[model samples]
Target: MGSSVAGLIGWRRATRICKTFLFSLILTTASGAVAQADCRADQVELRWPGGQARFSVELADDEAERARGLMHRETMPRSAGMLFAYETPRRAQFWMKNTLIPLDMIFADQQGVVTRVHSNAIPQDTTVIDGGDGVQFVLEINGGLAKRLGITAGAELRHPKIASSLWACDVE
Candidate 1:
């Protein structure tokens, strides 16, 4: 009888240890995922009714970079984009010119709210694609991606530079 009681206690102790180990593992995994998903300076995140999306981005915050745009790039990664930042809200006009890949332009206002999405602008086309007035930021991605991802006029953009973002960046 004594031996049986010891065995039962040992089993209970092992079971408790197993449960504790599993719980710790779950917490660690959950926290790791959250940490990995933290916002990055070179990344932009957009959210809409359809949920959210992330893109690795190259910033065009200066005059020279914004003027050059995405010109001469034959290929861009699927989850990558160019983010154009303006010092203040103003009308933004874009033309394809020397750009090789078709693009989708997402224009946002001062609050990081998307104001327009121009889908599938023809590659190398010289026609101006006006992003309208009060545009503070623009995200250029591969053509047709905006429509496919449900990125629209009302979506919210989150980036480190968007100081008044409705969707704030965690890393900032």
Candidate 2:
């Protein structure tokens, strides 16, 4: 009787361990899938007078994400950028505090038209770079790319956020 009872306890213990392991595996797999989907690259296009440039940008639409924008990163690909979207049009300001790499900040309106461009912002500088009133979106790219590509104030930005408005996406 004693042996039978001990065997039963061991079996239950083993079952519980197996269950915990399986649960952990499932949770890890699900979290990986979610991260992969969220990190998928989105594209934005900038159209100027005689040239156009396309970039793969990560969206920073939420407060927490925007607050942590590109800080402490040692390097960023020239073709990649971060797009900050706002709920409404208002003046915007950006600083390079804690940012390890220099960047060019492009300020755009609600319609995705470029309103201002702050080029070669010094890294870790706290000075505010202001986007004039009615600015709704801000795109940050590697420093000097704006000048190299000839992106100016008149350039128009096209992304999903502005596609529903005046700058509609070419495709459905």
Candidate 3:
């Protein structure tokens, strides 16, 4: 009777260990999936020439997002624009290689005024579209809309995060 009782206790201990191990594995996997889902920005509202236009923008602040800029997407919403925030204002250039949809690149200064506009960027083209000197931010929108709306150099942008980050309000 004593030996049988010991065996039963050992079996129960093993079962408890197995259950704990499986629960840990499930919890780890769930947390990882949640982290991946939260990595991309869902929507962003930006100020444009027309007014405050809300966009489902993908923020390209790092090398990963920069490399994946608008590629493979079948369509982009009209009110949406990708906002690429850089460390400093410089001459930025972009090309439409592997990009599925046409886009209008609106380049702006640190203060958000449009400094240059590259409209109708041809997909699969390696030709460099220059966003001339002192360009801090680049907003990608639908093709030809920049020209139609007169969203050229000197167009101001108004994103709360962008404006606050790059403006005097952020100064120490």
Tell me the whole-model lDDT of each prediction, alpha carbons only: 0.84, 0.79, 0.68
**RMSD (CA, Å), each prediction:** 14.3, 16.4, 17.8
Stretches of candidate 1 above 4 Å error? 1-36
Alpha-carbon deviation at 125 in model 2, angstroms: 0.5
Candidate maximizing TM-score: 1
Model 3 misplaced stretches (Cα beyond 4 Å)? 1-52, 164-172
**Model 1, range 1-172, lDDT digits (tens) per residue?**
9999999999999998787566334323322352347677798877776456778899999999999999999999877899999999999999999999999999999889999999999998999999999999999998987876678999888788887636666643
TM-scores, all candidates, are 0.77, 0.74, 0.64
As for model 1, its CA RMSD to the true structure in angstroms is 14.3
Q: Candidate 1, clashing residue pairs?
A: none
lDDT, candidate 2, 46-91, per-residue tens:
6666566667888998899899999999999767899999988998
**What is the model-wide C-alpha lDDT for candidate 2?**
0.79
TM-score of 1: 0.77
Error of 1 at 165 (Å): 4.9
